[model samples]
Structure formats: structure tokens, C-alpha cells
Target chain A: MHPINRRDFLKVASFGGLVFASGLSGCASRAAKSEADEFYFVQLSDTHWGFQGAPNPDAKVTLPKAVAAVNALDPQPDFIVFTGDLTHTTDDPAERRRRLAEFKKIISELKVKDVRLMPGEHDASLDRGEAYKEFFGETHYSFDHKGVHFIALDNVSDPAARIGEEQLAWLKADLAKQAADARIVVLTHRPLFPLFPQWDWATKDGEQAIELLMPHRNVTVFYGHIHQEHHFKTAHIEHHSAKSLIFPLPAPGSQPKRAPIAWDPAQPYRGLGFREVEAEHDEYKLTEYPVVKA
Target chain B: MKRRTLLLGALAAAMGSARAEPEVIRIVARKFVFEPAEITLRVGVPVILELTAPEVAMGFDAPGLKLNTEIPPGKPVRLAFTPDRPGEFEFVCDVFCGSGHEDMGGVVKVLP
Candidate 1:
């Protein structure tokens, strides 16, 4: 804010993001929606709602800014999905509830008709989404959206942070039940394959997840724990890390302390924000936009 | 009544002959770092660090102070230490914070 007022910059920045969203209009608009091209969901990850720290003066502003960015997209998503870390620390149950309530308030401001949610380690750090599920829905479940089979896995539980034996089994059976031609999309808080175990990432049992999804022809894994955006391919499956609405984290093993990537005072909210995932015709397009410049 | 009062006064005087107990030092926390990072206290004084945070998890970490405790956000946690030697001790926030996190450091000063 020293160089420019935050709110003023936010207005200009948000307009810029909207402009960017509109500018990307070309590559995406050609993707045309169809009964076969039917699956589309927004990825909103790492919204550490209750984070209070010096990394950013307005921890409060970052989340709302991301939501505004998401809402500004021209083609409204079929539904929006929050990847996880609904709150920070995850110590107090009341604090968790309070933060989730605030999350709802912020999301309520959005015009998107449908929204789905999942938990990351921060939100479920202590209680493992016991409170999150109470407010949202089942942590790991699956549904179908326009000829595509969608599965949301719970991978932020306990130290191992696996999809759990039960959820993995459910995923295998769910995939087995789907038609061979159906597009498969898996959602979880952590990346399925090891992105950076040194950073306490990579699910211990993610290999099982990878094996299960490998059989599918076209499968895209959606995850949100890393905060910084990244994409990797393991065994024919597409894995992606979503940006957090909270503070950005350093790359895995980037620092010796093993702490999260901190905020950059000069480039605050740089790679931290939201993305629009549109599956249409023959391809899936993920267009990312920063919240601050939104 | 005079005899009873005299007996009570004598008992109180006898109890006062014991050595003095140690004093405690308190430190409060919120958001990122602890308050009064450089705590000054007697070598034998019991330094009781009362760390409080709203929703950001933080810890009271100090090696010279020989103290470390992870205080999950929203709850107040207390860390107690008694530095045997008098010198400079360092404290840091173990929780990963953005940007100014490395700066979320503190110091403890022990007196002879």
C-alpha cells in the first residue's frame, strides 16, 4: 500500500483481471458446451479465511478479492468448488465455525448458483473437517455432471493424509461403475502424486489413487493445498495445484525452515488466486487469474 | 482471645522464615509474534510465557531459554523456563508466515 492504496489498486486490479478474463475469451469461447462437453467447475483453493499475520495487511481482502474475480467471469460456472484450508491453524472449533460462516458470507456475494466445498490440512488440521463437513457436506463423495464422473477425495486427514481406505475403494468402485467413455474428474485437497513430500505434501497413499485413476482414459485431478499454481502428470493422469485465496507458500524445499511460502510485500497476491476449469468438446481449459489485480 | 491471637502471630512469624519463591515473567502473542521478545529476568526467576493468538497458529520457540511449544491458534498456551546462566537468548516463530515471517523473531535477556 505504500506505493498505491490497496483498495484503489484493488479496483483497478480487479478491472484488469476482468479484462484478462475477457481477453482469454478467445481460446475458451471456442470450446462450446455440449451434452458430452458438459462438466465445468470452478476451483477455489486455500482460502485461509481466519489468517491474521503481517505477510499481508488485509488477509480479509484477499479472499473477497478472489471471489469477486471468480464471479466476474463471463460464462458462469456450473458450480464452484473450494479446494480446502477454509481457515487457518484449525485449533478452535468455534473459530472454525466462525470462519466458515464468514466464508459463506463471502461466497453468498457471488452470483454463481451452485458451490461445492472440500477441506485442506489447515482447515482440518486439528479436527479433520469434522466441522467443515457439518457445515458443507461429506468430505469425500462423487457425482456426475454431464456424462463425466466426478469424485472428491479427502486427502488432508492425519499425518499420512491419504484418501483413506474407504474413499479409495469408493473411487475404484465409482470408476468401475461409470461407462468406459465417461470423462473422469477427481477432486481432493492434496495432490494425488508426490509433488513435494519434503514440504509435507504428497499423499502417503496417493500411489493407490494414481493406480486407480490410471485405468481411466481421460482423468484430471483437481487439488488445492499448494496455494501456488502447478501442474504435473503422473501415469497418464493430469494433476494440478490451485492457488490459495490466503497467503502464498514457497515452493517445496525452497527454504530450509520447511515453512509455508510467505507473502512478498512488493508482489503481494502474485500467484495466489483462483482459476476457471471449463471442460468442453474435446479439451479442458484452466485459466488462472490473480485476485488482487481482479 | 489474647492467647489465641498471640499463638497465630507466632505461627505466622515462624512460616516467614522460609526462602523466597521465584517470580514469573509473562509474554502475550497475537497474529504472528510474541510481545516483549527480549524478556529480562533474574537467573532464577521462572519465566512464564503466556502466548495468546486469535486464529493464526504460533509457538514460543527459544533455545537459550530452552523452550519450545506449539500454540495452535485460538487457544492460549504457556511456556515456562528458567535460564540458569545470564546472557542473550533468541526466540522465533516456528509457524510458517508469509514475507515478514523471518522477521517474527524475539530475544530473551537474562540478568545475573
Candidate 2:
């Protein structure tokens, strides 16, 4: 693992020549930058700890590598957020517990101050996330840090993808406290929009959640579950889905069915990667890093 | 009277044949959703449900009728079963496809 300093962190953070709505380099130039000036966070999703298959022969190996990659990040991130699917699908109660426990034990190796987790259908929908919550606490909640409001929602907790009237009301009440101009980031397992109903990629009642968020001026959503990198612009909100730590799925409707792409021995961990987001007040820049260095 | 008895026998045999032959319904499962999301059939009649996915591998699971099968992309799997009662049986894609795996399901309505 390459040890990263603040300089090395900024060098990689400004990747791809991607520009934000505002200038982030200027924030980086300041010697004593305030917390709101610049901060970075890492997103790791779809680890699928218990997944054992041809698509990912070393599925377990990639996770520790991901943790080490984050730990090696220069300046380190404020925290690490795992989008969802900590474990593969399982119905047996004991197996479910075992998988969750194993996933927790493995992810605990991350050298970060805090690690936030959500749930994918594989982790939660079967038992309505009871097993997941028992390990990770509330599947959906909110917090504030460095003038940014972060909301974690559990759309997969219910197999039907219904957020329920209760959670919606809670969200409304939560948002009402924040000013309209507050920087907000929403996280979930599935795409909140109806990206493709046939594949279960959409939240059953996500429009309601979107409607509540529409009022916010600065809001971005980072989600996982699609197991690929995708960007969408809807109603002044930017939705980004990160790549999986395990395997990648076919593009939506690109094939007759949705299945994990077979792994290539020549290019191991080809589509498996994670994302780093650098936030500065109202602006945020994102860069995806593959588990295997190019 | 003999002619009337023959006529009655022929009518009963025709009905029996109709009951024995189930209607065929073809369903396609793709990313996140199923084509022909809802299907309706009559009770006491057998059905040949032809399930196929043109893209990747998927599965059809209707526990109510004890019907479950893996559907390979572009390969059709025919399931033959008779509806013994009238009700709606929900069938889900038992196989994981992607993020939308959970939403890949529809209702099989058995009508009286």
C-alpha cells in the first residue's frame, strides 16, 4: 500500500479534469483551509462478502484490498461509507447472521474514524433488514458534518421498495430543519428513480422521496446496487451509482437479463472499484479508483 | 334414446379434452421487470407457461403453485400445471439479476 500525504491526496482528488459547479482548487490553495473548504469521503459498495462464485473467485480478496486502498489514500478520508450488499443473498437465519458477522469483521479493518453502512436487497429485503439492522443499526438515518447534511435511506429494507409513509414523514420533518441552500447528500441501495422497473432497479415509491428532496437547492445522491458506474441528472439533483467491490452487472436493458459479468483472468478486478468524493461547501468532485492499480 | 346417450358421451369427452389441454403463455424477464407482468387463467384448466429471458440468466418462482425454474437467456422453459383453485399467485424472479432483482415479479391470476 502506498502511503499518501495531503499533497498526494489532492493530486488524485483532482482527477479526470472534471469540474464542479464551483472551484475546488481555490479551496485547496488555502494554507489553513476550513472544514467546509475541502473534505473527502470514500464509498465502498456491494462487497458481497459471502459471495462465492465464478464471477469473482477472489471476492473475499478484493475487499481487504479495497480497505487497504482507502487506508493508503493520502490525507485519508473523513469517513468511509459502504453503500450496500455487505453480504450475498442468504435465507437461512444462521447463515445470514454468519455472513453479516463476517462482513462486519472484515470491514472493521478499514483505518477510518467512522464507517456508515446501508443495505441491498440481498442483505435486507428477505428479512426486511432485521439481520442487517441488528448489526449496522438503523438502515436509514441522517447526520450533519462540516455544513453538509447526509441522509441514509433504506429503500431495500422492504422487498416492495416502499419507503413507507412513516419514513417519508420523518424525512420531510428532517429536511424542514435544514435551510433550502444546505448541501445535502442522499444515499440508498437502489436508484430512487425508475431507471428500469423490469430489473427491480427502482424504488417502488421513490418519487415521494424525490419530491421531498426536490425542495433542496444543493442535493446529490450516491447509491450502489447496479454494480456499475452511472450518472443521472434529474430535477436539479445528480444521482451517481458506484461500481461494486465484487462484480459488475450488465447495463440496464442492455441484455435480456441482468447478471454479473464473468471475471476475466487477464484483467482481474476489471470493473470492480470504489469512489472518492471531495466536498467543498456547495461543490463536490468525484473520482473512481479501481481496486487493482492500472 | 341411444342417439341421445351417444351425443351426451361425445360432449363429455370434448370437455375433458379441453380441460386436459392447458393454455400456453409466454413471459420474458429482462433487467428489473418482466414482460406480460400480469397473466390471467381459468381455474381447473392446465397451463403451459413458457418462460424465457433473452439477455442473461433469470428464474421464475411461484411458491403458491410449487413452480420454480431457472431460465437461461434465450432458452425457453415450459412449465405445465393446472390451477386447482381461483386466486392470485405472485411469482418472483428467484434468481438474482442485478439491483432490480427484487422487483422482477408479477401476478398469475387464476380466475373462476
Best by lDDT: 2
Off by over 4 Å in 1: A1-39, A260-262, B1-112
Candidate 1 lDDT for residue A60 = 82
DockQ of 2: 0.06
For candidate 1, write residues B1-112 as lDDT tens digits: 9999999998888787554344555666554566776777778766566777665665566655557666676777766667799887767664543324345667777889
User: In order, what lDDT does every prediction score?
Assistant: 0.69, 0.80
Predicted complex 2: CAPRI docking category: incorrect
Give one digit per residue, the lDDT tens place, for model 1 in A118-231. 887776645756777778878888887775678888887542365778888888888888754457778888877767544446676889988877766677788888777666
TM-score winner among the candidates? 2
What's candidate 1's DockQ score? 0.03
Model 1: pairs clashing at backbone N, Cα or C within 3 Å: A13-A293, A14-A294, A85-A120, A249-A261, A250-A261, A262-B98, A263-B98, A263-B99, B38-B107
Interface alpha-carbon RMSD, every candidate: 8.3, 8.0
